[model samples]
Target: MNNADLRQVVHANSGTTCQELAEMFSVSHETIRLHLHQLGKTWKLSKWSHMN
Candidate 1:
């Protein structure tokens, strides 16, 4: 997905988990984390029970 689209989705669903995002985009969670980082967003894995 393009950066703009990802950014829009992230902003629209600020509370969504990385896994959910990965699944939505048909990518890996790590890829979502990298994209989020590039978009100046930080994801706290500790916030999600399944991630920990």
Candidate 2:
């Protein structure tokens, strides 16, 4: 997916951890984290402990 779509996905799932998001997007967890960090939404990507 494109960056915009990725951003939307992340925004839509507030409590999802990077790992979960990565799984959903078929990408690596670190890639998801990096994308969010680049998008300035690292705060939106929940830490592992906060994931449901």
Candidate 3:
């Protein structure tokens, strides 16, 4: 349940790109990647398709 806001955003927009998430959160894409990694998720096929 960490980063719940980010997780909700990801779930709401399953097709959102990393760059988009970064823009939305006013952070770097690398930060988004790190959060996703911490959340046990991953990017695949141009989307954050893997979730946990």
RMSD, one per candidate, in order:
5.7, 5.6, 2.7
Ranking by lDDT: 3, 1, 2
Report how far off residue 32 is in candidate 2 (Å): 0.5
TM-score of each: 0.77, 0.69, 0.81
Q: Candidate 2: worst 10 consecutive residues by lDDT?
A: 43-52
**Per-model lDDT:** 0.74, 0.67, 0.83
- Which ranges in model 3 have alpha carbons more than 4 Å from their true place? none
Better of 1 and 3 by TM-score: 3
- Report the C-alpha lDDT of model 1 over 1-52, residue by residue, as the tens digit: 7768777887776778889888988999899888877777875653322122
Comparing 2 and 3 on TM-score, the stronger one? 3
Clashing pairs for predicted structure model 2, backbone only: none
lDDT of 3: 0.83
Candidate 2 residue-wise lDDT, 1-52, digit = tens: 5579777775666677777788888999888877776676645333322222
Error of 2 at 30 (Å): 0.7
Whose TM-score is greatest here? Answer: 3
Q: Which structure is stronger by TM-score: 1 or 2?
A: 1
